[model samples]
Target chain A: MIKALEDDLSQTFNIHFKNHDLLDEAFTQASYVNEHPHQGLKFYERIEFLGDAVLQIVVSEYLFKRYPEMPQGKLTRLRAAMVCEASFSDFAKECRFDRYIRLGKGEEKSGARQRPSLLCDIFESFIGALYLDQGRDAVERFVRIVIFPKLDEGRFDHIIDHKSELQELLQKNGDVEIDYELISEEGPENDLTFTVSVIADNQKLATGTGHSKKVAEQNAANMALQKMRGK
Target chain B: MIKALEDDLSQTFNIHFKNHDLLDEAFTQASYVNEHPHQGLKFYERIEFLGDAVLQIVVSEYLFKRYPEMPQGKLTRLRAAMVCEASFSDFAKECRFDRYIRLGKGEEKSGARQRPSLLCDIFESFIGALYLDQGRDAVERFVRIVIFPKLDEGRFDHIIDHKSELQELLQKNGDVEIDYELISEEGPENDLTFTVSVIADNQKLATGTGHSKKVAEQNAANMALQKMRGK
Candidate 1:
């Protein structure tokens, strides 16, 4: 079964697993390992760690060069938006990467293998395995081939417009209504500070204080934006 | 004058500069270029860009292996905290890096060279120039010699207490009250969601959010923590 999955993943990722056990370990969720530790299998969390870093480096470099004039803070926000789990899950599903994930009887019965989060993890672990098997340059090449295409196709300018982008996201996701509240105003009349809180439905998401109400709103919006983006 | 500066720098940084122009450019503030065309200099912003990525790669690789069990998010935060302009300024000042910066008559009168921000830029730009002149390994060695000594001396628990460190900084800096406010919450009741804004001294410093209010507050604190850590 492991060999067959390796063959299947090799076709999808276009890289053969030298030691097939790497793939086995990646697919073997901690639940399964806890159930049967004698299998000598580990979970993909370590690989996930490595792969996350690799993804950040690759994506950050791409965005840095792509938007050379952009300041560091914006670049950070953009990278966060692009490599977020939701986007990664979308990419993973598009590539049908979930089919290769190994699942225990319980997870398999519950259809946990098809989860976007699980798919994203397995995809990251796959990159980690590729790095181990083929090295950094090889992993970079694979990532560029697999991931950059989607990022390139994306309307990145929309990402820079944080408010509209976030509004669209909340609407599409059926998220609760997010409202901005003017929580406080302080300081001298000439240079007053405005404190704004972004409240989603009845709960507050983030509060921001700025020299002006607009800036405070934007700050609050940006924070709320990132929160949903991380989803 | 250049030779004297170089000797002083060499004694401090333990690295010899084969190209004095690179060193001069590294230490040249934008104000310097406003006068003295024969100073033949450029500002350090471009070099800061190059150095930022170079630092990220080096630190990422180092942290990846140093704490084999650390998560990617933690490594990222640690690297950001370590490589920020504020930290660079502190290190550079400790080595008298600001003293070497050349300024135009006007800037010299204003003490532009002594400004922490300018000093930090020169230090980072110097690292970029070193990477260009000597390559990654050499630059890495130079960084280790100049800065990591003090960082290494900290207790093991320092790695895990970014918020506490920031709080200590606030205490030392004096009279700054920091608070985090929940701005918004989204998603379903069962899963929930939250965003938080961090206010420092009645000014919004940063905002972050996660699955729970605690996580959101921590995230906001962490962002502010990163912002405060470098210098």
Candidate 2:
């Protein structure tokens, strides 16, 4: 078995897997193990479980420090988005983990190589292997290079933006026009309350009141999103 | 501010908090912060978030190393049972965290002192504080003392036993009779299979086939559990 990582893995990420067995296991699939049972090969799922915890702690600490005043509930939602299958698969692709996936012939033909869940699992197992090889600091450094840049670029900012969330949800089933209409303005100028209605695909879904137009629109979108979830 | 832990914390657990703020925050309830607005007291939720991740990695690593043959799905379920509100709260109580709980007058009057969720949060925040003060090894040592002994005592074994799980689920809403019957046996002596049916509260729940009567009963209970979850 080709158990050792390529030189680029060390040169790019400063990671040296002293344990070749773990490195091999990280790239191995369960199907591959089952197919070649006599080869004494191992799968990545066990390491993925460990790597998930490593990722969880790293993300949790990063968020805790980044947003000192933020509440736990919002931090949790943001963490979920960061470690989600879509995000992890993208990270795996960026790290070229897909190129190293070891699969049984059946799995390879079935296109398991390009599957998001498989990609996510391989990435996590890679992380798990890295954690075991070099401990949490090495894993943190790896994440700093691969994941933090995205967070710094505000890729995860949409997690807190209900308006963006509403747009994304509606846009999932193809493009749809989303309109925010200013329903009303009330009270004194200094203490004015704005009411906004969110209309998606010609349907007025929800109306919300807030201190500012942006806030009101966000609230409206929030209500609309909640309604959709309730169904 | 009483921002320091008693010497017993160090004596019993060998934990010394250099950052007394994190330690103080761990023991401070959210309600206390809400009530004492001018005092600048912080709640434990943020630290609890960090602590939860710290706890997760520790537990994950522990389980991974202990059970090399266990699958990820089973490992995940076992981890959940270990860190659940009921289990964590029990750990907190055993560590005498209840004596250190800081609550507002209203919360104290409402009996928040004995609440399991509150206990769990404090335990987690305490762990988070320890991680920040020390690091993963210290946190691991803490869990080794607090959580591992219970596991070694087979306290968490119930998590993997479907029969125990089904019994607990059925027993949740008071007592209910549960029975397992050997429905059939088939095939040659060396390749024989047993079919068992599980009945709960006089209603036939599910049937499963396995190599042995015990295995078949467990499989039946597993099916019943799945059906209950689906409903």
Candidate 3:
């Protein structure tokens, strides 16, 4: 499993870790360490701590250089939106990190591998391990390849909490009626999906789908905002 | 004034900026920009923003690597203590940054350069300017020379809120009577200085002096705690 995951990571990232143990530790959870005490594997917490700092600096530098005219307050908000849990989880899902996470029997039984927070931590841990094995340039390259493209493509727009933003934008021209309507619902009750459409001034602006109504509404609002901004 | 300040900074940091404008911007407050509208000098806010992130990653990486066995929580607390406003202000004062800050006449009259918040911002701004003028290696070296030695000497001991820390330490060995007494007061009412003594179980442990009673008490507690730890 480790070898297969390593190959996948290498193929995906176009980079390989010299110290395979760092890569191994990136996927190993604390619960897994408890069950495999003799294996001498470290958990992901420390690596996640380091990775969190690395991510902050890399993203902050990128934003600072990219937006020369942007105010500090906006840069801070943009950085927060970019590196929040949802964005990290999305990146993890795109990389198929859930397939590589090592969990104890109990944790595996509880489906902890599919958890968003766990995925986020593993993503950060992977960055940390990559940083230690390679260097800042490699880690920055990885971020550039995996994360910056997504930023350019507007993949993480939903993290911006755009409903309030859209309302605020519309409110500039006096009071305007903004609404999100459930357009469709599907799948089982436990895993139901929702599609919502955002309307402003009786015009259907945009539509989006998500696992929950609120998320769908937010996505729809975000799409509407992006279109409004002509992005 | 700018040329003299630049020479002073060059001597202080032992590194010269290729672009002297970055150094000028670092010390240029918003009020200064307001007064010198035709000078095309930018304020320190944006630079401070970048420097803040740079400082965080540098300090965090140092702590993470230095204390391999330290927990993430403790690392976070230590980083906060190291980079807090008070610590940055102290660093600024040590470099005599207040002597070089450019402020409008109103701010100068109000002693804005001596303000802790302003000092902290200027310190971070100086780092940002340094990072831009040089590179990461130069910025890291600057931090090593100027800041890391202080960590070794425990200059930021007061950042831990030593009064509470001392109380917690004493409380661990059952209840202990910890008292702070005003040992002496000097200067006039408007510019008075206070001397405080920390007494534990009727034994005077340490004494400290500050401009305010609260600061004097905290300094006294910090000194006592340091004595207890033999640091």
* Minimal lDDT window, size 10, model 1 chain B: B151-160
Summarize candidate 2's per-residue lDDT along A1-231 as a digit string, tens digits.
343345658667777789988999999999999999888888999999999999999989997876555678888899999988999999999988888888999999999999999999988999999999888889888999999777535476466677876776788558999999998999999999999999987899999888899878877876787687673
Better of 1 and 2 by TM-score: 2
lDDT tens per residue, model 1, A4-34: 6767667866677777777676666777777
Model 2 CAPRI quality: medium
| Model with the higher lDDT, candidate 1 or 3 | 3
lDDT of 2 by residue, B107-175 (tens): 999989899999999999999988988887888888889998786354764567778768877885689
Best by DockQ: 2
Give TM-score values for chain A, per-prediction.
0.63, 0.68, 0.68
Ranking by lDDT: 2, 3, 1
Q: For residues B29-86, could you state the per-residue lDDT of candidate 1 as single tens digits?
A: 6777778666446666656655666666666666665545455556666767777777
lDDT of 1: 0.69
Give the CAPRI class of candidate 3.
medium
* Error of model 3, residue B217, in angstroms: 23
How do the predictions measure up, each by TM-score?
A: 0.53, 0.68, 0.68
Q: Going through the candidates in order, what is chain B's TM-score?
A: 0.63, 0.67, 0.68
Query: Among all windows of ten consecutive residues in candidate 3 chain B, which has the lowest summed lDDT?
Result: B151-160
